[model samples]
Target: MKVRVLVSLKPGVLDPQGRAVHHALEGLGFAGVQDVRIGRTIELDLADDTNDEAIDRMCRQLLANLVIEDYSFERLGDGESA
Candidate 1:
């Protein structure tokens, strides 16, 4: 089974890295760039028998910092759904 986890900061949080990237993009002549937010994606290839609960635990325990970010996951395979 393949899992893709998207981890992003909560809406009210400040993302300095994203801001820096946005500035750099403008400096490089990219036009009309309004804003940028940085986040992380984690791809995991797990056993076919892995369950949703375990995945959720992984996200809570290590994959995301619950205090500052929100995370979502998708199972990526023809026979799977999240």
Candidate 2:
């Protein structure tokens, strides 16, 4: 099974990298941009029998920093609807 985990900074957390990209966009004459934020993705290959509870545990324990970040995930299977 293919699992994709997305991790992102919670609202109100300052992101220097995101800010830099926003500034660069403005410098390039891309106007009307208000703000920007960035996040990360982690892909995992797991046994087909992996259950949702275990996957959720993995995300809480290791995939994301719960104190400052939020995360979400999904399982992707070939020709299978999500």
Candidate 3:
């Protein structure tokens, strides 16, 4: 099975990389832009029988920082590419 994990900073947390990108956009004359937030995507191929509990543990223990980050996952069918 294929799984995609989306990890992002929790609300009220600072995101320096996102700020830098936003600044660069304005510098390049991209107007009307508002706030920016950055996140990451992790794609994994695991055994077909992998359980949700195991996947959740993977996120809580290693994939994400529970202190300031939030995560969600999507299971993809065999025919799905992403």
lDDT (Cα atoms) of all candidates against the true structure: 0.94, 0.91, 0.96
lDDT of 3 by residue, 9-65 (tens): 999999999999999999999998898899999999999889999999999999999
The residue-level lDDT of candidate 2 at 11 comes to: 96
Model 1 TM-score, 2 decimals? 0.88
Report the lDDT of model 1 for residue 3: 96
Q: List the residue pairs that clash in candidate 2.
A: none
For 1-82, candidate 1 gives per-residue lDDT tens digits of: 8899999999989999999999999999999999999999998988999999999999999999999999999899775653
Q: Give the alpha carbon lDDT tens digit for every residue of 29-73 in model 2.
A: 999989999999998888999999999999899999999999999
Give the Å shift of residue 29 in candidate 1: 1.3
Which run of 10 residues does model 2 get worst, by summed lDDT?
73-82
2 or 3, which is superior by lDDT?
Answer: 3
What is the TM-score of each predicted model, taking all chains together? 0.88, 0.88, 0.91
Top candidate by lDDT:
3
Runs with alpha carbons beyond 4 Å of true place in candidate 1: 78-82
RMSD of each: 3.0, 2.4, 1.1
Note the residue pairs that clash in candidate 3: none
